[model samples]
Target chain A: MNNSSDPKKYKNSFLNWIEFRLPIVSYIEREYKDYPMPKNCNYFWSFGAMATILLVVLIVTGIFLAMNYTPHTDLAFNSVERIMRDVNYGWLLRYLHSNGAAFFFIVVYIHIMRGMYYGSYKYPRELNWILGVFIFLLMMATAFLGYTLPWGQMSYWGATVITNLFSAIPVIGEGLKTWILGDYTVGNATLNRFFALHYVLPFVIFGVVALHVAAVHVHGSNNPSGIDIKSKNDTVNFFPYMIIKDTLAICVFGFIIAAVVFFGPNLMAEVDNYIPANPMVTPSHIVANWYLAPFYAILRAVPDKLGGVALMFASILILFFLPWLDRVKIRSCNYRPIFKWFMMLFFVNFFVLGYVGMKPAEGIYLLVARMGLIYYFVFLLLITPFIGRIEKTKKLPLSISNILNNNHSEQNKFQKEVN
Target chain B: MRFIFTILFCFTFCFSIFAASETKNAPKHEWSFTGLNGTFDKSAIQRGYKVYREVCAGCHSMNLLYYRDLIDIGFTNDEIKAIASEYTVIDGPNDEGEMFERPAKSFDRFVSPYLNEQEARYSNNGSYPPDLSVITKAKINGPDYIYNLLLGYVDPPEDFELGDGMYYNKWKEGEQIAMAQPLDEGYVDYDDGTENSLEQLAEDVTTFLVWSAEPELEERKSLGIKVLLFFVVAGLFVFIAKNRLWKSVN
Candidate 1:
């Protein structure tokens, strides 16, 4: 064995450890050192940090839930109830787990929109954008699977409908469906598999998230100007500056989550989920968890199952091509005249579709959903590319500093006029 | 100012009307199973427990419940301890220095198969055993649904044909149930010398399962009342705080 306190050897080991750890923190600080962030990057930027905190909260709460959760079909629903009623602080645990999911989606949506408004998907940062899309997809899958573990009517029937969608394939439709089900239908077999996948997928998402942050670190965050941050003078360190802002945002978000948990624990959950699953009867409305409602609406908007599934997928996948499809040189809608209005209309259209999705798919609601679905596709595929090229844009300030300088000049002129 | 006030008044009136109408028009489905009403039946729960132990326990597991839970569910201590002793053992810091794994203790719950993911799935034709603790709540239909499903399975009509690998049962409308109802008359010889009928066994097990699902239903309902009281107090405090804080500003 080596001597316990050889100075040279000790020095070498210390150096090795530092060499491994130093680059990560220093690299983050070094790369972001002069990277100009928007002075106007308000509470929106906090969503990303809030999303990060929510993810951590979810993983921790999920672990505790897993400890008490019985994954068997006969026992899974009962185990959840047991957690709520029997286990020590089981109610709090269940409340935290369920509400944490809602908060996670809320923060993530805001985070993604923050990226959208600021053109965070533009060149060099495209990988980060794609990773985010991937994360969103994984999150959706995880949530869907997690929801099914309860084997409630919604969980069972929802899985049945979703897994059966694989049967839409032309040749191997039935076979594929059977393969996915691992049985004749969405029974114990399906529930068991979903449980396994639900547990496994989150860790996979965590891996992808690691890559996402790494990519974001590599390219750096895109500000509202969409200009290269390296070219500007006003910049701050990620640790103290961004960290502090993120912490404050997290506190506010925590307040919101606490309020939901304390006052209205089941506000976001459906009442039907309180019951056990029976395949013989279906619920009146088979809606997914709230995070998935937007896409579910798009799916229902189409008349054909295959077509609806395709459209629903395209709705999300369309976001992946945004960096390239958007031809406009400018990033933010704040400066884009015509594009700004279109973006607002598109947001409202999507919300309308969400509303229509929750309603029975018939009569006026169907018509509304169809119309909203058309706009949903048009906004992404046609309008995004078309507007990017055709819209006449105003000349943007060379940098954030230039915008500030112009504002100062304009203020001085107003004072002179007043005098 | 009058026009603005009138518009606000109209909007509030319309909103309230809409809300009231929506609530009234909300769909009400048949919620009761077996058309039975009142508090849960303890006898039914006891029967359900029997059905679970004899039938479902062979394949499915409820690893969350301890032997002691039976006592809470209306079983005698002697009966529970007897059942527990048959299944598990206790060994710790006794006169003997050696560690021993013996029959389960009265406090011990059912143990799941100690199979890992790969092993569990492989043994069950690519399906893992799910824990039963929360299955009732996880499903969309409540206990009635589970009960209906359990009793739904029957032999298919003579003209009906099931596809390959599909098992036909008359109880299910689709003519297939993954699980064959394990409860049959006289399947288990009751320890307490009670005559065990299939229907009686099924009802008992279902009740037991429901109890296991929500052991603290009574506690939760009472706690809900307490929480509502707290909210009432908090609301009043908030009202006072708002008045005090905004008094000078107004």
Candidate 2:
């Protein structure tokens, strides 16, 4: 066939590329043009997009950092310093990577809270919530492993202590611990393994995040009203509006992250980490990173090792069962006064526990920790279930539309009287 | 939602306990070096430089430090320059007038054995002489343990038999140590007129190693305080903004 006579083939190839090779801007526009976002979605909805942006920032900075980092126990710490001192703008890279981690966790926690407030985990969205939890777990694992790669004193000891937790199991606990450590202690073998895992786990997290988004896309976002979008009038398409909103949010979030990196690079890091790993000497206060501090506090609240481990694990696992735990027919917490109060209290208790976790585990601190711990569990297992039931029986609108209509009528009556 | 909360609460509770216990028992670990005042003996650091130059530098590297850092540890600039110049050469371009990598700079990282990976491994019995820049921090026991371990090497215990290809050191907590205590009395001729004792040398080198590990210790602490101040200011601003934003709605 003469090439000059093959205009149809050229046109066909161009169409194929358009169909298969996803163009970034066009794809974003088409996908989000009429995105069925709720009109009443507030600041809370920004958190998921915020988390997604933070993840990308973290991944980009982390990949750059990895290029210069030496993961061996011997050179890891020095390599990090070399990056700070020698590599061009390496300090900036490190700060962004690290602070990005903190920001990521912060956004994720808020995102999860938003889900809770909106009952986003209920009904067909349960799997979406579950996948989100899976993403959270993977994020935690990846962060833990990545933290060990710097090979700081904290990194080594933190890895050692956490790995040793596996020994809490009854029978083959020691073996399991050894297997995890890959040696008698957290040393070269441990660092190497952590390096390998740290590199691999992020991809696993990426996969899970894909699943999480897919689930979200499938079920669609839960609205502030928690009402189903059954008709065209109730729903919007996925394009333009939401895409622009998300883009703006990402830009704002990125600006904040950049500010953190530029001005206060190691603001969130501990001082002791500047020191290399010393196997014989330990840092006086061996604290986990700030992101894990809350859970760490929870772990410390329990007196027993096995119990603490179980509770620590349960803290994360609890999110998976949120859909069943909430008994209210109503999805949003907006109308549930008692439930609203409990949620606020729970948030305060969690923060308090984080504070206690960082303190010296003394007499009063332990007691407070225990109490906080108790309230934390009660909020979920007892308060939520009980409050939801009580609220359901109390004076309530039959539907979200009914509640809106009543509010509208009340507003009209007030306006009429004023006129 | 209730189950989720319950599990979260339980886990948080457990995490708090673990953290608490860790703090409570933190002092017991040999590796725990929390309150280590970076206040090292200057003479020790000087002595460490000697040991490093004589023994450790031959195979183990500490490419992170400069000759200038030795001044803070006690050497004069003249002494540091003289010492560094012996190891490095400075060259510059005629047109650009920019200094290029001719030899080690005063602040250049310690030199490694110029061997390729295979050569370095083969010569060292598959053990690479790890960089000493953060060796003190990398080990759990900190500088004291590193000092001790360097001096601890001895023949295997009488009762314990030795495995082929394994070197045994009874003084070490572990029976096997990759390094033979490289430092020995009169191993190197010291130009500084310091007494040449193996223990003294080991102490010096360990101190120097610690310094290399955290060269910006003083700066980091000061910067940390400044950052804290900035954080407080930022927090205050955010708090005010939040109050203003929510006032009408509330």
For model 2 the TM-score comes to 0.64
DockQ of each: 0.07, 0.06
User: What DockQ does candidate 2 score?
Assistant: 0.06
lDDT value for model 1: 0.69
The CAPRI category of model 2 is: incorrect
How many pairs in model 1 have backbone atoms within 3 A of each other, for residues 3 or more apart or on separate chains, i.e. clashes?
55
Name the runs in model 1 displaced over 4 angstroms.
A1-17, A20-25, A28-36, A230-232, A405-419, B1-22, B25-250
Fnat, one value per model: 0.09, 0.05
Chain A: TM-score in each model: 0.91, 0.89
Query: Candidate 1: what's its TM-score on chain B?
Result: 0.61
Candidate 1: tens digits of C-alpha lDDT, residues A248-299: 5554455556655654465567656765787777887787675677788888
Single out the weakest 10-residue window by summed lDDT for candidate 1 chain B. B29-38
